[model samples]
Target: MSSLIEGYNYDIFISYCQKDNKHDGWVTEFVDNLKGELESTFKEEISVYFDINPHDGLLETHDVDESLKEKLKCLVFIPIISRTYCDQRSFAWEHEFIAFVEQASKDQFGLKVKLPNGNVAGRVLPVRIYDLDDNDVRLYESVLDTVLRGIEFIYREPGVNRPLKPDDDEKINLNRTKYRNQINKTANAVRDVITALEHYDHEPVTVAKDIFKPASIPSETGKTKIVTGSLILLALIVLGFFLLPKLLKSEGEPEKTIAVLLFQNYSGDPSQEYMCNGLTNEIIGHLYKIKSFDRVVPIDYVLPYRGTDKKPSRIADELKVNYILSGNFNTTRDTVRITAHLIDPRKDKILWQNGFDQPYKRIITIPADIATQIADCLKTNLTALEKQNIERIPTTNLEAYQLIQQTKNQFNTRTYESLNQLYDLSLKAIDLDPGYADAYAGAGSMLILTGTTFQHTAMQTVIEDALKLWRKALELDQNNASAHCGLALYNDWIIWDYIRAEEEFLKAIELSPNNQSFMKGYSEFLQKRNRLEDARAYKVKAEDDPIRIDILSLVLSGEKDEAHKYLNTYLQSKKIFAGEYFIWLEDYEAAKSICEAALQKKSQSMLAPRYQACLALAYYKTNDHHKAQMIIDQLIEKSDISLAGSPEFYTGWYYSGIGKIDSAFYWLEKAYKNRCPEIPWLKVDPGFKNIRSDDRYWDLYERAGHKAYDDYRAGLKRRKSNR
Candidate 1:
């Protein structure tokens, strides 16, 4: 299609570097969306000159300039501005962007136009994907000889800089811009420029120059022809303003963030809650796959509100989300009924409500269908990859799918017994469907968790099984987030391979950014690597449980007073583990008091093992050798089975505190052999001060990459001192 006006080959010319689309295909997606928007915006077919297959289209003998010159005779020019697009040597910048500007300036319109609303506008519209430096901004301005302003599609967050996607939550995005809304604005702006060009080309509507300005209105009646034409022009302008749909709105659109709660189990059978909850997560999983949809709350964050009758607005406020999706899942003997609602909690508005009644066999596909509809209702763009992910069924065997859902519920329980059950259920799922990647990951994750938490499992066996399971899971489906995280754990704990572990952790994060569980593990990995500032940044972001904050106070390095303040607040309700904080602060008396009280209250419960170790450390520090010895004996007996972590490290610390140098070294060696999670932080832990001056301690530290830690900390200190 050609331009609406004669003598032009295209209506809009899109200029961008080929490299911009190499990885994410960002520029190609932008141009495709623009074409779709233009089709809806214009009654005439709008031609876009996008060099998508330039290599194939432009042969070696083809005169590229002659071909581009005809296409460059366009009404509007859109240059996708990026960090790389500013180079004067690039073909897009030199031949296309600059060439169009110079060519258009010599044309009759002179690159600027007078709108019917009496406002001046530019024909060159720049779509910015990355924020430019001052020098690039000056280069762009120097060409136009005017201030630069256009649409922005940049996604900004702490330590994140990328192009905005259709799914980015405007509430969380600092730019407060939506991709769909920006596309509409571009379409409308294109309409305005085209309309102005048409008027000038026809030499019609002279009143349009100052139609809205009272000062420009003539007072004389002698020029009756001009006055009569002004009235006709005024009438048409008013008519078009009211009749035009796309131009009426696009600016100041409300920011939105959504939380998906578990689907209410109304099947009247309690056994079906697993299916309901699975449907909820599957829907969330589909949404997460859509990179454009960036702000759906993670499942762990919504688990607390599972069966509540709390109002959507209240739930949204508590979760710091603007939208909520809640629904009911009911089933009969042969049929299932599902109802879902997407609501704007702040306005108490139901944006979209849907219900489906289908055969129970169809339940496997409902989640993806609902996910696609929700994305459409929210007006988020669905990339080809996202669409494929949503439509792709994980497992066709209903029984196997059910077992995976059961595994999900079991993993959420997270007790020692529950983890074992989850692992068994995963095996059953794999038996039912050998190709299911999630099932393999589920079983492998249990091995990682149990090995790291309970050192009784054979270290070499867990390492072998974990490696095989995680690798198999990824071989089947490389996009499996759990599989990536599992491999990351295997590398971190088993072989102590920090480089490969970091890569797998990043892979998991890239695949599933909303998974707080993955974020928690990654943060711990970062902490052990001595990147404390980056670690705490992600630790605070992964906020599914309050107890994790309790752990953060111990791991994060900062003001001693601040850590004490957090411990005090934690002790008001959670007093059992105060000794660890007291030990960290070197307040032996306070630690002994807290741990003594805790052991007296819950000596026989699960808290026994944790409080026992803490109290023993306190006893040794206070010079009560007899009591410390007895407590350490009991702790050693129960150490292998403790659900609480790091009993091995604590035992080693206790031996060091008592000045039993040989015993302390023996325990520390055992701890390192078992791949105790705390072994990586041996160099900086405060409890090992008594042993730090010893030659053996230095040997162990160097073995655990102490030199690397020192280098990382030195760089981190220079980059960030607050942590």
Candidate 2:
């Protein structure tokens, strides 16, 4: 179609049965339509070499091997798979299909080998244009199946900008469903093959089977033995039926789970909202530590019920918990009043109820007192250590408590203005009481986030300041879980100090064994280290706070679909801190959208600007560079944040997208200097995959401290040698 094709390479190769084309008169039309679609989609002239082309002399003289090889090198392959394609005389169809399959298999395996063996390979992708029945499909089953298994389908229809017809829609949907099922099967097959391929390099562990059976006895004793076995089986079944329930009853019923809903603001002054929320959260936190007692879900998980017309009983039932803790908090300028009641959802009875009035400042200790009283009433043993943990409030400074509450609230809003306000307030809290460990920890975390999100001019300076604050908090209170977690975040992301991060994370876990947030952060660190299995184990061990546990588990398991579902559901139902949670999962689009929505509600939120920047990167991921640039421009215009702090990290991503390798390398170097947390992930990151073979890329990877990359390469070499 273009003179450029003759000058350069093959554009398209049409492989079809000459008999089918000659008799049905449909093949030519199909070829022409496919060429048009390719041209339209790619916005370039595509030269299609059909076997049935009118240039008879050229076809006869065409170097079939060279032509197919050249076709394989092109962007796409169109294999016309009609019933007649199975004919042996169909050399075009046979040759093309075989070439496609061989290329695909070679690509999948050869590339892996070449990485270690210094060999080169080709890739093949397939396009199926005609329908064939089961028996007919069997003819080219190996080739078609291999191609289907190896490559993702790029769908194209005959019409221009036309929606599928009703029948066509049904057909396409059916095909898609079928394809998905086959692909899953193929994935499993590929996994098995890869596992086998690695066998020479490593020992294979035996997998436990679901069905357990005793080893069979010698077959000398047959009919009588079989009869005896049947009788014993019947007797065992009868025994099991009678004993299973009794055994379960003797073991006792499963522990009932309970959640405490946020206390209602009956004080009439909305300004006291923070006090009520803080009290509720503290109570939930206290109850959460009692692992031996009825489990208490976090108040954050239950906040979706507040202000809604739904009855407390209905809410409790929806959460599928046995009990509900509902309360109302009334506070004046000097004193606070609390009325709390625990209800049994199953029995629909109030199990416990209490009221307390204390000095407003002492409200911080109310949760421990209430929990102790409740545990006593329930006849549950509260170990001395557990009791101490519940009662432990790190700071008595009312100003610090108020600041922490406000900072947490603003952070949850996830807007740029809110984050700035939170930063200012947290700093003020620290200034008010320098010994406030929680304030310092919160400030450090916020500053680190600010450095990344807003492209702060003094990002490194801010992060360093954050690090100091966190270290100070830890020094003041060695067992402070939040402070330890903050230090871990700094070490892992900002300093590229993996060893320190790991130590801090492990220390945090040791100090606050049941703190789900700390466990999640630790799990994320393990993932970054390429210890996938260890990451999963830690995530599983994290406290089963639904939001935290589910999100962390999804991320560790690489279940992006489930993770997105859970996050969207949580965001729709409740207001909680999840911005960083989304970013950790690399769901930047969702994070940005959530932040933008929050901005609409709280216009001054500082977190919104950072989230907008995150969104720009997501756009970059999708190759919508214009949209990404626009968002970045908007952030620059609205905020005084400078890219210099984490310029390399951010610019590395932007330049990589535009194929500006040198620029990417420059920025990536800067990111490393700034200690951007994402540096370690660059090795396996598909964004840098294009430049991976470059010597500079390998140098960067080595500098990033991902020893696993070296291990992977070594593993590949071992595989090749074994082969």
Candidate 3:
């Protein structure tokens, strides 16, 4: 009978006693509503098995239906537990629940699967319409050896408990909401289990112990208890040895990768370019809420594709994605028309396409609808929570959303005035809509970027303001990934709370794992702690992002040559990186040449002093102390007024390179106090290794919140010995 069905015969099997169905037909109505919701939730047709005929008992001589036995191979076994259902030991309990339980016991019975919250949950889901008695709970929990958790449908009034009906909520107005919530929960749970099962890689599960077979008639009550107890004991042993370990590992598969291409401007008016760009950016943001995607190429990365004559497959290869989403937008007098197409680049096929032509006021709905449609076409298993997150529009105010999108477009312009202007725009967005979460997140990011702007406020005051803005953003939308990422940066750099910063970064990644900003921050955080291998893994996870490729993990891992090769191949302006690498390799001539070339290219750039300092370091290494000293003196005078934080850090570098240990420590401490951005590179930057033998160097390292893996291992060893 089990062999009759392939992967899954039914999406869900609803088991209930006939008496519940007779009681105002609650079961029938519930099934009907569930079917309707299933249709709306799933792209494919959902097959649900609900036996309507009342068969109170199954006699020993009564022939069992082969079709019923075949239908038991369902993805989800939703036992509609009620007082009558729990008390009976007939077809509901025997053939429906126990039969499937026995079959699963022979498979990976207790292997925990990943949940939407990055946790794990079991497979057997229950829908409770009546309170479970002690016996009812024992029978189920014994076989599973876990709590009998379910989506409970019993409504508790002041002193009464009753099954929730679809139309019974006149006073509280919560019955319908509760029912819908449970349905959604059940549907999403089934999806989670199926996804985990499809992706899980592990040893085969088998029952080594004796298998108990039921007689022609069901087992006697005492015998049933013994059988169930033995199964529970064996399950405990299996779980202790197997399932517990698998819970810590993730299920693996080909990652769901996507790239959002630049939206074409069909709006004839070139002055409305901002609107078209904003719409494209907003669509990307909405798509980011779909946690199923492993990568979503950010707007900046895909901007080059706007006018290029590249094929979808070629662009997909460049972006390293399985799918590409491109669209066109036209803004008319009172309406906007947006068309979206999702292409499978491997086959150069259009998998899904849709268009929305709506009034300007209703424009906010377009992104959500487009994201949902793409997910449906890709067959992405979105949980109810993820679906709600994807559908949530940031704000109803078009001006607020438009302003925030414009800020995203201009965020890369990291000038003092440009960033301050972006901050002002964010404030304007918030004024238009006080509850806009993205506006607050945008404002916080701009404040963080323009931290050195003396035109507005001090760095400390800017940090505090940015922190508050991010907090407000989280208050408005707790699941805002950008808000979490901004807070992660604040905690890491300003507050120096390494543990809290890591937690925030991880939370942001969990909310939107494909976001490059979160991935880069996490990589830098791991690097700061001197976890080079761990940092490298995160760097590779975000390798599609050009900015993230400049991490120091490769050089720190003693692969400086590999780093140099990558820079030589990938970066067009590789002189600065090559100079850094040559300094690490002790090739003074090569380092000096690279630095001189970089300075010649941009003698007036903000980083010119840093290049000059590097050249001086190379000069000192090559036994040219006279030239090195002259250049260092010129830099110390010329960079005295530079607003950029590089002057302090490079001054320390020049001193350190010339073997002036005390002077190096003084300038390094000054840079640390000044909150130079280069402080994060202290652990991996080879220049700092010169003074590692000094106590002051260790003190500075500790102040920078650095730690090694050996430190953690030593702590573990101490705890173990104490125990």
Candidate 4:
């Protein structure tokens, strides 16, 4: 902990009305961007307090008030003021704002303080989202008795009266400077105020001569020394009795940060690799159940290191972990041998090593056995929930579990043929054990991959089938994270149930908090919804999968030049998102080259068709309608009503690029009707520019549930005069 934060429970507290967070979430975005800006501004970790549940009832509940009072010992308080925020007699204003004002005024240090920059500001920092009613404005002034010189997030242009919407990012409007810049200013102001507060708190306490007279004793120093000495003795006694034991217990414990490298396959058969990988994944799953663990490297991040010559020490350095778990698995016809080692990478010492042979039928217990051993070695206790998780088995049938494991391993390949085989194996597992939740989850995943991997003639049917499998899996076991993820995808993409999708996504994360796939999927979902700031927050959580989402972060942060540089480096190994970046940067030739190259290299890949779609769009941008039309015809031939909705969206993109508004609108409508997940991105998509003026665009946009698009279209008229 930094000295600046020693006395404060939180560096910042965000106060806002629940209504301001509705409709794609304005308050959510504001907090996300502010948190990011603060992280970038400070070197030390900063704690921010924000309560999402509006009905947590700060005044009604004693527990809530106790928590809030402790949190209110913060360095800065940010109140997001809007018309709704001011007018409503909500806890945000009456309990939080007024309460904090009264608390700060009666404090010994006072409410107003001179900052290091020679400016006096109150502790309650206001953030205006709208020019409020005169009476509302007077309310804040009357409480604080200072001019409300707060940060403004809204466009204060002439004739403009509403808050900024997400869709304003699309068009090149002079008044629309990047939203991040306004967030930066607010974050910086909060940081300044916090620093000044820290300085004030750290200042020496001075006694006023007029307030208190010294004792009329000749030996004043002698009396002071006696009192101070007695206090020191009392403190030492308390420290010895209570705090020393805990300090010593913590000191002797191992560092909680660890990374598990991919388990080596000693069977010497490439076909049996899946079993080893699955064992490794199961071990990691068990490890994450331990609440005391700060960080446990996920399997996806460690998979690339398998069969490589990389040293464990170097791996630990890259992962920023103190300990490493490495082991190997070898299986015979009816039994398996496992050797495990825990190493302190920095010192190159093996803290623990063990070998065990267990019957193949009892393979499901291996993870729990290993996790228990490691927990004992580290002197960590397993909570009841974690213990139960370790003991739970996915299926009674061992063969079915093995089949599910093998199928999951195929997903790492990311090829059309591999996914097809995975789908077949998943069904085989389900046939083997109909009551198996893991098998059902595997089956549901296969359906989604199949919909995305192939040219589907009936995409909706495939998605519906997948959704049924996900529900069945949950019926078998409500704690299945994979099933929750499958349902989240189906809800977001197929059913267009935005709220349900978020709920399912959050449920998946709650079930398996360390899973990177759920994190990445939710981040992408937020991005498509034009909640880039929220996307950034999730992207930070999904840091293990860096290459997958870095481009989007750079582009959204107004770092196109940096994104281009990264794209060049990123394209060296894979061409998977390079075309999208090139398109965003308006480099049609570069986009065309990469997409064409990928199509030629892996023509049978599930991703190849999407790359081909990108190629067609690039060709259209380059005015090569002849080649672009030829590719579009091929895609149309392959696409049916049942496939994933990508083909329809790409077709729409091609038509929109070529100035065919009717055709573009037709395909876009089809995309929406089919529940194409890509439809969520339509508002911010560059290709939609030419058709945005058409009434049909608004119709489809509204049908796609993008209120931001409607708001942006309405606000375009006031752009030029805002400056």
Candidate 5:
């Protein structure tokens, strides 16, 4: 029998303070409302398990470990941070919060096996239900600084009347608005942090140094010493001219290469861990605008060496780059000091270095100054408008600046919890200054991530809210690329308005040419329109990250060998699993094998679901219909209906393999109508060779809108004749 609860799969795990629950039943009420909202939002009636439930049989039977283990196996820990919640004695707080952090870190960084038993743990969602002072949070300062740095903390107004009370609709509405805004901000923050963590773990170092070296001191006879010094200098110059170009050649082009290293944190408070990342992102954003530069990779590409014993020269050699830029920020209460250096990687010497200090508000101009300084050193000309654009600050508010940094951190993490955190933070920034367009844009992105992950019940509402926020953002700032991209994605996925999506995507690309997301999204749009050549071209122009390049190459070539080669290089460089890379090669069997191996090493990965789907497809392809059906059925039952598409596509393949022509046609028709790119392979696929002679097969092929198939053959003959 097909079962939904074959094993303990958790929807939510509630972490709350027993003390807070003691007074006025606040925790209980919050839990009830949250459960209702999640269930209503996802359309799945999920069981909400709490650590503090008094009548729990597991507690009485001394099976807390076993029960909690099972609970953790299927759990998404929701930490409710309040004043009392942060209290160390709160066992509910300690057990849940610690366990959640450990699990989440393991899931994210693959750190599960570090424990004694070497079992992987699940992820956690830290939800702040009430306000807590900095001091209260400080008690668990280390934990907060590490796991909860980018988490969304939902806060309710203190002394607000209870919702259960009569005639409290006004307060309830106010509180609901507050909670909604908080929830939205947290959601956004969670998404940002998760995305950052997933993508930006490596920091790229841009080589910076003083180009003009100090002249060597002369001996007593200065005139006589000039001969030796001049000869030495001349020889050095000659050696550089002959050898530098040959040594610094990149893979394709030999343009100036730059790497933005991790920014130094000036903030003395260790809790403010995101400041360095924020600074790094800002510099990267500015540099990304210079189109004349052939390649500018982010420090994130080299994150594996963070805190390692490797030198900058070693890293540069591995990346095969020419330059590295390093910087430090020192900030006081009212002033900020910044120092930066550019180095030549080949020479292992500093080419340029500079320092600047200014009032906190004036730090925005640092980008232009740094850019101009580096440009002068490199002998690259920058237009006046580019200089002005570099200096421009989107917002003057310090809070907004801080919020942007926090949002960026959260965005990079790319987990559900991180998305929620980003949303909450962005919402708070918006509330602080409703005129802040970027905050709204960030919130919209959070909504999109959330909808993409959960994809049911409240998805429409979430997406609509995202659109409204993006529109509001654009209304405030017409040229906001982030807002434009957010709207484009919203239109493309939720609304299915491809034309509008295309327009917005183009506008975003025009505004921010080097933005990786915009490039990838635009490429996908081109592919959707059957513009494969255009898609391939754009994919080449997009950022050359391992995952992105691998997927793009697979889409363009459909050659497993090429895909595998690229994926192997990527794996060697990154020293990590590339799950999506395996999927792109259509080597589902290999992908499934790797994922299973990873799971055995660290079982609690969210990647399991995605890989499970891949395995099902592989089984279907190999004609193991029963196994494929079993896996697909389980996935459909456990996951959202959107997951049903893949299984359905495979079902058609299975039917076709067994000579069920009518059923095969039914499935293939559905797949083709959905514009499944994989559907085209059916025309040339050996699995369906049996049906090639059928007249109905030709009709189905025509229905798939591949007129180019005939055109390509004719063009081939014409080209041969001409040759």
Candidate 6:
């Protein structure tokens, strides 16, 4: 039978290994049930092609049947992916699976199509019956160019990895998925794919209602006048036919995903390159505010391509983005000249290009204007609030604006000196313009970072400085999202007040819902609170130490194997993560070796007190009290004031190791009063394990604003039923 959308042989083609059906006809049963579900789903007749007796046609590619090629030209190809289904030598894998992908990709609808409901689906739909190995999943994802997501049909258990049976007890299954629901989901997905294919070429109809209108000529018109009017009407129809589909696909939300790279400095001046980066960030910031742009890739993804001569298409291919917005910026005296090109990097073709020549004083307006133009060209509808935020000018004083931009550029360098430079620059920016909320917020965040990360200032001083600065920023601009985030971090790390932290987080989210970094912070905060399930629901991009964060999550959930695997990825570049996780796992000897190796290289102050403290703690744990004391003495000689949860916090660990319970609690309480960053990890931190049984520990744990220690541990045990 021909396909429902025409130019096709069948509506659905079921491809599988013949061995799959030999196991009590699992493949056959699934196909039968899918067909039954499709009948109720579609008002139109659904045609399905299923071969009961399949031949393993492993001959040359040319020997494959021409009729099978036509048969593979279906709307949806449901591959029954079993343990042996994806083998390279298999007939179905080569002839049906790969063949259909090549054929559909060249067809009118393409291999992947956007559904009417706005989700993208591939022509190859896998009904996976076996949990796939990582290599196999990667192989499939390479071809699909997306994560391997599909309807899972496997019944999982401690040792079982097989096809789910129709009569299987779902309550006992690890997957907790019924066999019938899988079939229904498959049918619905097939319907979505086919329905989208049917209407793919006719999307212009949805928008043509507004563009194409009938024209009425006067009854007494002259012949030339009537002809002219009719020609104008014909021209309008032609324009709608030619332009509307390209403009209004997905109802003004095109399926193009994009990243705006740092614009190049056309002035041939290195100093001006920062200006280009500032513009890039401004454009990206504006794009993020546009709610219709659901797939705007973050600037972090494009940072590696900053000074490279790589083609936009090549960059897009590596970034897994289809669109690349790249440009060049030049300012000559009073005028700023900027050129931008929105390119479909897959085809290496420029979809849109424009240049702006405006006064350098008005340079702040260009990024927003360019963003809106690109959005318009892509047919993405924008909210009024989004437009306002993008267009709103910050500080009419251009020097202060430029200082703020320069201040923002320092952190991207990631130098040890960048934090101090960032703080100084932000302070200068605020001095120039007292009303600059972002600068104030940046200054406040830097205080916390420099104080905790590098011990440049006292913890108490950092908290006081940050709160005042952050509060002043918010007072200046109530809509400032940066100030809100700074306040959230203050409450999260310094105060350990979960309620206020969450309130600030929610406020920041309300102001900037598309700010993924905020969501990522909130996700970590939720995980810290042990709301594991809730934390998993928000998938956001992390800014720094992403693998460490992942390892932290895995370790908390008692997935030591997974945590170690992630930690190994950061072994060379960031050994601190491995050392930290090792200590948590009680592998002090390994931690000692790593910290020692790390200390042997570079300046003593490079990662001061961090590896030193870790190394000292490792020594104490291994019963080498003398080596521990020596390192502790070195840290003590360097500073009378402790930084982060360190030095004094380190002293507390050494005391705890030596069974000095009173001394340990004393230093710990001091760290707690200063709101040590490590206080929030009270329940899981192995540092205080020796003193945890003491009454003072529970009082301190609860005082640090966490749930009661005993109750919290009970909750953890309840939530995690031995994984």
Please list the C-alpha lDDT of all candidates, in the order they appear. 0.72, 0.57, 0.69, 0.70, 0.57, 0.72
Query: Candidate 2, residues 1-723: lDDT per residue as tens digits?
Result: 432223324445556666556654556755565454455444445565676742211233355556556555432345555555554445555456566556644432331211122111122323343433333443454343211223222222221112112233323331222333323432332233333333323222222121212211111135635754675467558757454344332365545477777788999999878777777777766775654554566555676777778766678778767778788999778998999988876677888999989998887788888887777766554544456667677678888888787777555434337456778888999888888877888888777666653344455567667767776776565556777778777667765555556656765664555566776787777666555555565676554334554565566567867877778765674242465457546766666566556656763333344345455666665567788788656644542344443434645655674567887787677667756656766754434655677788877776665553345435534633443
- Summarize candidate 4's per-residue lDDT along 463-562 as a digit string, tens digits: 7777777777876766678888887787667655555466568767655656667878888777666655566666776674454355666665678788
Residue 232, candidate 1: C-alpha displacement in angstroms: 50
| Per-residue C-alpha lDDT of model 3 across residues 238-338, encoded as one tens digit per residue | 86755544422256444668888777888888766666666667777766766666677787788777778988989988888888888888887999898
| Tens-digit lDDT track of model 6 for 161-226 | 789988898766645567887788899888888888877863321111223221111111256356
Clashes per candidate, residues 3 or more apart or on different chains: 3, 14, 0, 8, 66, 0
CA-RMSD of model 1: 15.8
**Pairing residues by index, what is the TM-score of model 6?**
0.59
- Best by the TM-score measure: 3
Candidate 4: worst-modelled 10 consecutive residues by lDDT: 209-218
User: If scored against the real structure, what TM-score would every candidate get?
Assistant: 0.61, 0.50, 0.62, 0.59, 0.51, 0.59
RMSD, every candidate, angstroms: 15.8, 27.4, 16.0, 18.7, 28.4, 20.9
Error of 2 at 232 (Å): 32
lDDT of 1 by residue, 1-723 (tens): 788888777889998877788788888898889889989998988988888854222324445666887889999999988887876666777778788999987787768876776456688989899866435665687677554557778885433458888888865653456789889989998999889988875332221121232211112233644665676567667767554334223566554467889999998899898898888888888777654554778777788897788888889889888778889999989999999999998799999999999989789899999998988898765644456656767788889889888778656534336456677888898899889887888888876665554334444456667667776776576667888888777667655656556657876776666567777888888766655545665677676343334444454455567677767765665465566767777777788887777666664422434456668878878888789888888767656665245566668877876678888888888777766656776755566778888999988876665565465445533532322
Q: Where in model 3 is the C-alpha error above 4 Å?
A: 1-255, 308-310, 345-348, 412-417, 451-461, 544-574, 603-609, 634-643, 707-723
lDDT of candidate 4? 0.70
Q: Model 2 segments beyond 4 Å from truth?
A: 1-252, 288-296, 331-334, 373-385, 409-417, 452-459, 533-641, 644-647, 654-663, 708-723
Which model, 3 or 4, shows the larger lDDT?
A: 4
